[model samples]
Target: METRKGLKPALVAAAVAAAFAAPVEARITKIEITSRGPAFGGVEFPGVGAYERLVGVASGEVNPASSNNSMIVDVNLAPKNARGNVEYKFDFYILKPVDLSKGNHRVMYEPPNRGGKTFGPFNRTTGGNDPSSTTNPLGQFLAPRGYTMVFSGWDKAAGTNTANFNATITLPIAKNADGTSITGPSYEYIVMGNATTTSYNLNYPAASLTDKSAAKLTRRARIDDAATVIPATGWDFVDANSIKLLPDGTTFAANDIYEFSYVAKDPTVNGLGLAAVRDWNSFLRFNVTDDSGTANPLAGDVQKIYTYVLSQPGRLLNDFRYYGFNQDESGRKVFDGMLQWIAAADGLNLNLRFSQPQRTQRNRQDQLYAEGIFPFAHQSTTDPLTGKTAGRYDKCLASNTCPLALEVYSANEYWVKAASLFHTNPAGTQDLADPPYARYYLMSSHQHGTGNGTARGSCQQLGNPLNANPTLRALFIALDQWATNGTAPPPSAIPRLADGTLAAAMPQSGMGFPNIPGVQYTGLKSTRFLLNYGPQFDSGIMTINPPATVAPFFDNPANGKIYPTFVPKTDSDGNDVAGIKVPDVMVPLATYTGWSLRAAANGGPDGCEGSGQMIPFAKTRADREAAADPRLSVAERYGTFGQYMYARGNSIVQLMNQRLLLDEDAYAEYTAGLAAVRAGSLLKDE
Candidate 1:
């Protein structure tokens, strides 16, 4: 890889030359570029001119004998290439400026969330999977800034490969030392949305498809209750990887918890996904070509690398750092900075035998998976409950390879994903300050995804449509400036125990939620428990399929014996009192809550998975009194559209001054909001 002009010549050349020209160990052997064409149909970005897209397969190998890969669960048992290195191949996609001179010396890497290429709120474009389409303004924001965008597959079970976004990896299955099959306890849970749904594809194939004796099927009324075993005769194995209820016309209860636990075989070397990401990013940044001499597209252009991952894949980023995958084979840093979006306190259910990377336990379904465990914080600290001390950056800190991190999550994370554990101690008694290298921000009064702020779906209340994208765009710029220049970002804007904003989640525990008309405020949250998955749990092997739970000592008085957790306190309008105040939350048209209960038909009273409620205030003061609504009327809060715009504009200006909102985003949102307000679409006063 060559150094671009304008950088410190001696330093850049010396560093890159030594890394690339030196005798290589285990690295990317080949990059087979399958397709090459103009991105966005030859659309020219502002200063970057036109960008080109490169889609390909990246083949790499890792030495199992090396200490760098020893943490991989079954690396020792994986099949090796002729060079005695464990081999892996994954699909990759890259969009870079056609001319290197016109590019910024940075790579914006987005690891696919379950095989889909999403920008994680940074881009307002729809169908972000297809970055090459001219119809969609995909990559319009970053491409103009001359950023080289990158993506690649890491999950082995990335089911179907869409033409627009196919990022799948191939990994070897772990076997016994004698080359025999290895099996482990695998569990799958299903909640039928309707009665007609009968079959489910298991995470892994059953060890013995014919042997129904060992496999057990059970049903429970709720996620927390004890499950009653459904007799084996009530179900049949449709195949090695699927199951169906017995008697062709049989149906399951709409919201009942159906659990299946069995001995599953052929576990992929799932942990290799971490290595794949590390090495690919390393290759793009430092190497000019692979061993096969396939040119590294952005080899000379990449001086800094940053990653943005959302939801499940965001959890993967957490696992990647925890297991020391941030340091490549040459002991160099992989990502210079990381923006982890929406993955709160949970780690991925990966890096273990029979790994289920997609399992995320919500308040209503998929309960008790191997996630939301200890070592939730980035800084190493002692867990008062488990008596263990560790952190996500422990390994990186020891190796001097820790990346600057920014953890951005929404209110849903606080309600459903145990986000409080990310900022607090394991016992939740006190808030722990973030490390100097990290910043944590909360998207106040927002849900997991953007919504239209309407009453629809199976939830008991109207959907929350608080858009956090404007704030996200600003923060991303802040992160880039902090990493590229010496400029520090804005202070973390999260609720804290030190402040009065962070409080108990339940209304009974003094959350101070307002009583809106026709709204049920049960204050249900996804409870965390101290789980024991047998003695081998720490070693990434779960001997017990459904682990036993142990109550923590620091118990919550409101929830009885359970792990302590907290949520951000609410204002009179039910919006979160803390965090970056967006325009919608500032001006206020309705009360937005992070938790929304499922309707009676689905599962009444349980918090809707990843959903938040938007209960509109009454139109007029008379309407509020007539409906017995405790919340004030929208007209009373803002007499006219002019007042509404004034308030929202003031809020946007404040955020801009703090560098928490960009000018372009602020202007766009203000105009759009003003239009809606003028049309009486945003605030109704009939």
Candidate 2:
């Protein structure tokens, strides 16, 4: 009962404040109503109470404990001008002992009904057709419940700005049942869009309407179609030799130069030109000059570089050569040399280079041999000094002076090296580790020239052959994490298959050798043959024509012997040759399922089982029936591949853009390259 005494004065003060704040503007202001109140006060405006109790208050009655009742307020704001065509209505509730200092407690209001028709534009339509009736009974029921409501125009010109609408509603609180004056908080509401000039006098007829305009709509392109079409405005392919001088006569000294080369194989279509390759070269550049116009090359300098090298001259563009690397040993030495020279001449470091070779060849006798086809073929031959095979090499083989080590360097390695240099220890320095890069990954069982091996068993069926090397997934994850997080990723975070679980571990070297009959040496051999040795001995021996192609043979399919036979074929030298046998390994591609299969599998009265085997197989009759159905759409067949591609491409672009923003030097170079491509002058005229 003591609580009632405290509420009366608070309600009176809130009412006084609302009366003063209402007339400051004649135009309506929008307000959002919510059921909850701000901290510090339990009071609500437009208080709530029983109908009889409120009636008693209107007649100046008294009830000491009545402060606990709720009150409802009807807000009405009439346009001041005689020509005013809009009226604002607001309804809200107030809790007992209202706090005037805090804003009014607000409640959401529903629109009113006119002749059984809802007042809003959205309620008038149904499924591309006009509904048979547009009546809203809910709105009509609230009208006689002591609630005030009105129709108003959301006109922009009537207000100071385009955002604020021309009209609003205001509610004033009066005395309550106990002869105690009730204070009401101020309230406002505004809607979006322009309203026509019209007045309603309760009995006025509804305005004539036109066909309602629809909201702007956008449809996603077909996924398969999108994947097949080349990008129109974003990055495309470029050429290795496409770099040319800017039309504005920007000349570069030998030291100011950057060269990027790569062998790009056009797997899509062949014979592309400079024009077709320029789109991808467009990029943003930043940070080459200081405030005083001095040339300063900090770690962040950025520029866009684009170059593509096809299999043949003037052919379709395929791969890219982006020349942005750290000044380290693992990167192109020639490029680093050029930058040093440029820095000495221009007082800034400007040298950078990147290259991609279609295939690298190496001399077998060299101490630091470039890993080529031959070493792999001869991997079974062991060196007496070291217990390891001659062809076996580790990550640091090139620097270790191993005679059998062959390093097939790539441009991606240089990018990784550059990224590591900028982000890792000895921060901001260009010095990079030897081989300044990481490992080269060969995927197992992947298709479309990706690699051969089973990457994961979870997606495998009965016939799929599992890949032995499981660390490939981890390497890629590491690369992405390194690019995203500055911290060097630990090998454990990379995904790998250990036992049955997906785990992370270091990548193991690929073993290429296969044991064959009569090949005295055994162990890992090259996946592909490198050479054809002549079969004959010395000339002084008895004159007998020698067989051609003296390569070692495994078991003869006919006799199961080591002897070579000309039955398969013979070369010009008359040496016997055996037919090459391609491996017939069955690799798992992807799995397909239907909605019907899912429904049937989960249709039991009991809950679904958690065991892997408990899940039904696709070969079930129900699954087959679902597959045979013709009504299934092409989208159903592809699963989410299209969506996945779109998301992946977007992610790649986002990452590149973010990197461009962070690295000034790289961004500048990228922008310059883009500009050259845009001007149709990236390639030399000759």
Name the best candidate (by TM-score): 1
lDDT of 1 at 275: 89
- Model 1, 1-686: lDDT tens per residue? 22333345664575568555665556788999988998878888765678888888999989888888888889888998788889999999888889867787788898898888878357656546667664754445677777788999899878556476678899998889899889888888888888788788888888897887778888866554666777888898889988889886677778887878888988899889988999899888778778866777876667789887778888999999998888887788899888878888889888887787767877776765788788888878787766899999999999999889889998999989889989998788889987989999998888887765656577888788887777777777888888878578888989999898987765533887887768887777877777666689888897755522212211333223356888999887788999877887887777887777888777676668888888877788998999998888878888876777778888889989999887777788888678657665545433
Report RMSD (Å) for each prediction in the order shown. Answer: 3.2, 34.9
In model 2, the number of clashes is 71
Error of 1 at 444 (Å): 0.7
Of candidate 2, the 10-residue stretch with the lowest lDDT total is 339-348
Give stretches of model 2 more than 4 Å off: 1-444, 450-486, 490-619, 622-686
Off by over 4 Å in 1: 1-12, 19-25, 136-139, 547-561, 679-686
The TM-scores of all predictions, comma-separated, are 0.94, 0.19
lDDT value, candidate 1, whole model:
0.80
| lDDT to native, each model | 0.80, 0.18
